[model samples]
Target: RIIEGYDGLGIVSTIDPGQGLVVVWVTPDTQDEVTHILHFFPRALNY
Candidate 1:
């Protein structure tokens, strides 16, 4: 549930549903990068 919210951000390196834990690696270092990520994955932003 938690990771789903960050669907457009980055990769999920690790997850523990029981503990409600999630690790994400977002690499949007610049404005353009962030725009690209959101552009490519529009559904993620809606979530």
Candidate 2:
């Protein structure tokens, strides 16, 4: 929901729910911003 709040920032997609795998796609212009925002999230296994 937090990422959803930002317009055109990025999107989080579930790749494998069972393994808790996901992907985040961010706009080139918003890469830095997205990186900053992502810093707040808990680090995932093998990330």
Candidate 3:
């Protein structure tokens, strides 16, 4: 939800709901922006 809020940034999908696993498909040229956003998120992402 948070990642998707950023336009042209990325789209997140659930890989395993039970394990809280998900994937973020980021757009080309937006890696830095996405990484920055993820860094400040409340929940830590397992990259």
Candidate 4:
């Protein structure tokens, strides 16, 4: 659901959501933006 609003920022391709195995793909240019966005999550998801 997170990636739904931030389409160009990143993508989440997880075969099994229950396993908590979420694959996030972010390009080099989008790294800073991704990091900034993740900060709002209270470090719940760290790369």
Candidate 5:
């Protein structure tokens, strides 16, 4: 899903509700991407 900020700056993050896995696209918005992923999956991490 695409998550947009209050200023419209956003990133695309995919969340697998069934598997409870949130996949985030890392590029320009690496920080935003991670934030988005965590927003969807509070316990998500690379490890």
Candidate 6:
């Protein structure tokens, strides 16, 4: 699913069933803006 920020910044967070990993894609400019997205999925936890 895709989640967007209040400012219209966002990221596409998806679980790659075949890879067994959560893939996150965002624009280079919004790399820092994706912190919240990363937090939602916690890098410490497994996808």
Candidate 6 C-alpha error for residue 31, in Å: 0.4
Q: List the candidate 5 regions with Cα displacement exceeding 4 Å.
A: 1-10, 28-44
What stretches of model 4 exceed 4 Å from their correct place? none
lDDT of 4 at 20: 78
Angstrom error of the Cα, residue 44, model 1: value is: 22
Please list the Cα RMSD from the true structure of every candidate, rounded to 1 decimal place.
Answer: 7.4, 2.2, 1.2, 1.9, 5.0, 4.3
Instruction: List model 1 lDDT by residue over 1-47, tens digit each.
Output: 44346456555554678865555556646435545555675354421
Q: Please, what is the whole-model Cα lDDT of each candidate in the order they appear?
A: 0.52, 0.77, 0.85, 0.77, 0.52, 0.56
Query: Backbone clashes in each candidate structure, one number apiece?
Result: 0, 0, 0, 0, 0, 0
lDDT of 6 by residue, 13-34 (tens): 5577687566555567877756
- For model 4, residues 1-47, the per-residue Cα lDDT tens digits are 66557879888788577877777788999889877877787547757
Q: Write the per-residue lDDT of candidate 2 for residues 1-47, one digit (tens) a residue.
A: 66788978988798999987777788779889977877787764333
Q: Indicate whether candidate 3 or candidate 5 has the larger lDDT.
A: 3
lDDT of 3 at 12: 85
- Which pairs, if any, clash in model 5? none
| Regions of model 2 farther than 4 Å from truth | 44-47
TM-score of each: 0.33, 0.70, 0.83, 0.70, 0.30, 0.39
Top candidate when judged by lDDT against the true structure: 3
Model 2 residue 20 lDDT?
Answer: 74
lDDT of 3 at 4: 74
